[model samples]
Target: MDPLYTTTDDPNDSMENISSNFTDSYNNQFVQPVWQVVVWAIAYCSIVIVSVVGNIVVIWIILAHKRMRTVTNYFLVNLAFAEASMAAFNTVINFVYSVHNEWYFGLGYCRFHNFFPIAAVFASIYSMTAIALDRYMAIIHPLQQRLSSAETKLVIGVIWVLALLLAFPQYFYSTTAELPGRIVCYIDWPEYKIWDFKLTYQICVTVLIYILPLVIMGVAYLVVGLSLWASEIPGDCTDRYREQLTAKRKVVKMMIVVVCTFALCWLPYHVYFLLHMFHPDLLEERFIQQVYLAIMWLAMSSTMYNPMIYCLLNDRFRAGFKQAFYWCPFVPEGSYKSLELKTTRYLQTQISMYRVSRMDTTVSTVLPFGTPDDTTEPAREEEPGCLRHTAVDLSPNGSTRDTHSKTTPPPSPTTTWTSED
Candidate 1:
């Protein structure tokens, strides 16, 4: 197969050839217009500010609210944490590089600059995928437990491991290259910095991060979305099952929005590198090269986006964020952890009550009453639930039957209620 890109193939030679071949001059646009700088600066600031405040609040919310801890929300928490790390450590350095045209940090940080972004992207993509699958399972099989707290821990551990493993190239294969009086970070590859192994790895990252996972994400969202809309569970609106389905639909829709944004943002950078697979000639154009850089930055910027998605779109998360941001009354000072504990207690109490009620109606009612001698009636009354009773009789065959005839009454008002087996 032909090589994707060969650095030694003569970039200057192609430029000279193109210059001589064309009537109009090759107009390599220097840095984008000034307004673009203003716009990007504003974006960068928003990203950085939101990245910090947003993620801290995200972390605070998850840690501060028992209600926020779920299979899918946990993945979002991981994603937000990773993005916060990037915004704090990486984003500014990128700005410095763009403006000063040099890497102010040493070789170590240059490695980190590449390494962190790759890791962050990996974390974000997989986290979103994890959430997607979790939602799918929850919607499709609510009766069956999908992931437990321990299982969620295992999944998270695997995510970090995979993220580091995928980011392997950036740590070792990367090096600082001297480009036009500025030291910039690029991969030191098999043949050279910009060719061969570097190109190969770029393609690999794109496939792993964007293409394959994107395909999986699409299928996951499709299954989840369809299930929500087309559930066999009936109710116009107030039905219990339908209400649950409605909630599931809202969650899947938000997930779709986040995932689609991710795919669109990263597609360009992937295509820019993959283009080399067919024609290395395409990359020779300086304009094309700048566009490539822009695409990559935009993709990197997406790391800071999901936390925004969570904070703005999710009501629970929005409340938590407000508390963290404005010291809203919901989150008390120095007692957020206590608040979470209270929330846990509250949910547990609710669950316990429901269990007791169900057991009282099912098993507790079927058992004989405490007064064994009280067999005045032919048989005990059948209770659907609660104190509600129906007189059921035991036929000569000794099989219990539902007899709704009002003539029979419970031996005692406090007797156990019986329901269908």
Candidate 2:
């Protein structure tokens, strides 16, 4: 007489009574038509294919390229790992079970099917939450020390540990039962006199996996958006500073799109499950099977959208994707190579320029002599027993002119510029 199972043709017969009437062939009353099943199968299969491939590629892009291994990308790796794992392990299985209303995979898989999705979802959203906090720290408090690579890895580990703990109850309570004509897998929560344990657990899972993280990210992004958009650029800000600000804004925008996509995809799923818990009669409606399929498909579709979003909104990710698929017929030759690789001479020149600029600031600030006056005198290069000298002139237009004079050639510079996410 469990609410999960529908009554047999005989309205008065209980599940126990119905089970005795069938031995071999199960009457699947919820079965859809052949065409509807085929369409649903195609939809679900597409989610699996795109999600697994897209997320795996995202993981590879982050982990394979040393240049791509930042704190944000590390969190992205975790997010991709969770999404790919869920899509590969759970999506199609969930489709088959939901559509057929039978559990063919036995008790162990049933437990895993229920348990791992929760854990994966937990890891996925909280990875996003971690990214939001990281972004907030970076933009709102630029001087604060950001998470190092080691610290980021440790945080990812802690996220998984917490996810497993949160999902453990689902695994423990999951069991398979031989109902009227079919074996079914479900969570068998023990009843309590004071409250409905199942409903309470569902509510907790919904909050932890969906509501709470969304709230945190919402607040973080709201502040970040205001700061980035509402503030005016300083009059003296350099082009490099302006470029950096634009880059930060792009990153925040990309993440907001990703977060919104995730929220929209999962909102209906949480609503559906919550309603099912409270109004069990809704499950008995004739159209409910199709409703469940549509909702589940939308939720699972979230797994595939992030890689697409990154490709669209991020230049580096787009370049990485191009690099990954460079073998394609349409990709221009040598395009991918330039995305991450720079010439040694180009890097050296950039480093030298950066050093010379820094040296100019230092020499102007700490020298014993006052600021240099306009003069056509050529400064002499370094001689043994004398300090380096350079000539600087202030033009009428307020630009400082520097003579091409150096006491010593800048040492061969080794640093290279790296683009961040």
Candidate 3:
């Protein structure tokens, strides 16, 4: 058989095999040419619709809401922006490549294709870590100055820097490799280097981005949940029930919605990479590869989910969306409370206010309240006092671990909880 005609699955095939057999194998792998094209096209279009629309709304919600303009939300907005970019720049082009099995965008973009996802995903994962830390601070130490707007901005800045740092290797090593009938892009790592670099990179990044952050977030949320649970009110009067219901249910539910979704979406992608590392034969299996790709895509889809979780799980986000999108009896003269979230009575001294967001600073009127119902399934409220806070605690003086006080009660319910679904 000619070298160019060999199957990728055929161990004996050479890169020189650029003949009819290669075409046959490639076509057979897809099974039906038209169906493969159709499926890819449909998948691409769906991803585009979801990533663009969902992330745009997420950005808008964070941008438009004053309360959401905080440090944590700022990182979230950055994440939303990153995912939107990946969708616009990466997903559509990847679809084209899948359909044609060719790289026409030239060497530069081939490098871009090879490198950008690494950067974007890195930024994305790092942003989540930042958010996780932020929540950890707020939940563990309620009295301390939680993340300031300035600090959040700095953290976001650092995340991008780290992402680029990790991604910089791409600029040095990626290029298109030509074959008789095909061209492919890859990093310059040889077998040993590739395995070493990829393994180290994957392990470290996973620990920082997924494992450690998750472990910390888990603990913080647990403490927060426990705090809220301790504050839950017993049945009897309506007003006390309502007060406790509002405070606890809204906070706890929103936290669960955010953290749980993050965990679930990211798991598949992480596992796929792990499996790929140990099983070269598994990679050769077309169906398995497809499954791996699907999971990676699913994890990428989380960028669009924050808005949904925020709106559906929290009455406050829901009200904010309503205010953002529809009519107001008043000329947008609404309090955050009117949007359903009560502002903290105390300013809660922050350690380093990080010179950002002056009181006079105005936000662009772009966010819709709650989440849009059309994009995903409508969510029902769960048990009362269930809304948990998403924040990380800090030492009162901003010391790494000391000087923090524990005073504010998780604030017990003065009202009854209806456990609305």
Best by TM-score: 2
Q: On a 0 to 1 TM-score scale, where does candidate 1 land against the true structure?
A: 0.68
- Candidate 2 structure quality by residue, lDDT tens digits, 222-311: 999998888786555434345556666788898899999999999998897777666656766767778878888899999999999998
Model 3 TM-score relative to the real fold? 0.67
- Candidate 3 overall lDDT versus native: 0.54
Q: Which residues of candidate 1, in runs, are more than 4 Å off?
A: 1-39, 177-180, 192-196, 232-238, 276-293, 327-421
Question: Residues 37-88, candidate 3, lDDT per residue (tens digit)?
Answer: 6776677667767777767766777666554565555776787788788877
In what order do the candidates fall by TM-score, top score first? 2, 1, 3
Q: lDDT per prediction?
A: 0.57, 0.70, 0.54
- What does candidate 1's lDDT look like per residue over 1-421, in tens digits? 0111122122222333533422243232334667766766676666688777777777777765655565666787787888788887877667555533446677788777768777777888888889877766655554344576678879988988898898876777556544333454554545655666656676788888788888888998887667666545432222322333444556677788889888887777667656765576775565653464466467657766676787556655655555565545654344233223112101110111111242223122222211111101111211111222243444456666664532323334544323220
TM-score for all models, in order of appearance: 0.68, 0.78, 0.67
Model 1: how far residue 196 lies from native, Å: 5.0
Query: How far is each candidate from the true structure, as Cα RMSD in Å?
Result: 11.1, 11.1, 12.4
Clashes of each: 2, 0, 45
Better of 1 and 3 by lDDT: 1
Superposition error at 244 for model 1 (Å) = 1.5
Which parts of model 3 are misplaced by more than 4 Å?
Answer: 1-28, 65-67, 191-195, 230-249, 320-421
